[model samples]
Target: MLRFILGLVLVVGLWSAAPVAQAQNADIEATISAQLEAFKVDDFDQAFTYASPTIQGLFRTPENFGNMVRGGYPMVWRPSEVTYLELKETAGFLFQRVMITDAEGAVHLLEYQMVQMDGTWKINGVRLLANPPATA
Candidate 1:
């Protein structure tokens, strides 16, 4: 009888945990989507708000952040098309994979680092990933 009760409790616990994890994933995706939308319109000020405090500190101001993104990550600044791929969590940080096509039609893979601050998810950093070669 005790064994059955313990199993039931474990099942209940796992079931409850699943939704929390899903909610977190949804929130993280929403944050990234909102930032991308802001970028679409060149709304640097709005985009900057989605950055984590550490990133904001490093860039100092919205214009500075905007300049960096425009110069260093042109694909992100003006992506022809964007697609969300996967979200993974490691060491308490979330990483989201995104596929972006540049204006010239080159595809780029990027991983976005996200951190939660004050119960809100904010973008910490973005790293460009190498695209695999295409075989015909």
Candidate 2:
């Protein structure tokens, strides 16, 4: 029947798309992990490379960006544990959720806005989720 054929087509399309979505998520996670590793080693220049062009322009220099992270997001700057959560899209923008445990063992939930530039995922910005974390 026509309905059955259309349903089958939809299912097939989604089935093939699953792998592409998974790969994209993996790439996004890798970018975040690399930035965290760079922060661990105090390599601002390396960490800054993962940021989106807009962020780079706003910070203007790696040192400025590093200082901002060190002061404003101490948890991210020196996270003791990092866990990647769900990646969601809202209004055509993708945001990757992450749970980071700071050096003091405090848990912080953050959403990293991700943007793809020239076939690579880059971190556009990060925002801390409010209290009672993970509820976001």
Candidate 3:
């Protein structure tokens, strides 16, 4: 009887967790979509809105952030398609792994950190796939 009750509890727990998971994924996708739209139209201000607060503090201004994305992370600056998969939690924050295809048809793997701030999921950090620098 105890084992059966435990099993029931586990099932109920997982079922209740589903909506939160789905909402998280939806928020991530919406964020990427908004950022991509801003990039396409060269709307730096709107693009800045998608950035996590930590990111905003790092770059200090939208122009600098925009410049970095345009220069350093070129894939993110000009993504043609963004697909998200597999959300994971790390240290009380949610992380999303996504693959973005750039205008040049190159694929880039990116991980986005999502956190709850003011009752909404906001992107906080982005990790690019590691790549060896072009050695001269």
Candidate 4:
């Protein structure tokens, strides 16, 4: 009887948790997820849509931009356990900081400088930081 009750409780818990686990991504998470998904599918055109105007000028072609992201930053190209750490406003624009953990358990801190033009936040640049000490 005790085992039956425990099994029933576990089943009910999992059933109730499904919705939250599958919930829609928040604004910041959605932006990052969109970019990642685009890159994963090799859709540079779709990925470029998220870039700020300044970024567009820096890398005119999708190939150039994708190459920069893939080769220069292999950590970001193949990252796991990505988490949005913070979103802070600077001057009149907003900046987001995302922390990514690689397959080898290395942390890659990325600073996504954002600017809101006409109400939509666009990523202007990505600054990769050196991995902090394990204690950090």
Q: Each model's C-alpha lDDT?
A: 0.91, 0.95, 0.81, 0.76
Candidate with better TM-score, 3 vs 4: 3
With candidate 3 superimposed using the best TM-score fit, by how many Å does residue 101's alpha carbon deviate from the native? 0.9
Task: Please report the candidate that would top TM-score against the real structure.
Answer: 2
Error of 4 at 135 (Å): 4.3
Kindly state the number of residue pairs that clash in model 2. Answer: 0
lDDT of 2 by residue, 1-136 (tens): 9999999999999999999999999999999999999999999999999999999999999999999999999999999999999999999999999999999878888999999999999999999996444434
Off by over 4 Å in 2: 133-136
By lDDT, the best candidate is 2
In terms of TM-score, how similar is model 1 to the real structure? 0.85
Report the Cα lDDT for candidate 3.
Answer: 0.81
On residues 1-136, what C-alpha lDDT tens digit does candidate 3 reach at each position? 9999999999999999999779868877788777878887778888888887888899888899889888887788778878877888878778888888889877778888887777666778789975324445
TM-score of each: 0.85, 0.93, 0.87, 0.72
Candidate 3 to native Cα RMSD, angstroms = 4.2
Candidates sorted by TM-score, best first: 2, 3, 1, 4
Q: Which scores greater on lDDT, model 2 or model 4?
A: 2
Put down candidate 4 lDDT per residue, 76-101, tens digits, no spaces: 66777788877767886566778888
Which regions of candidate 1 deviate over 4 angstroms? Answer: 1-12
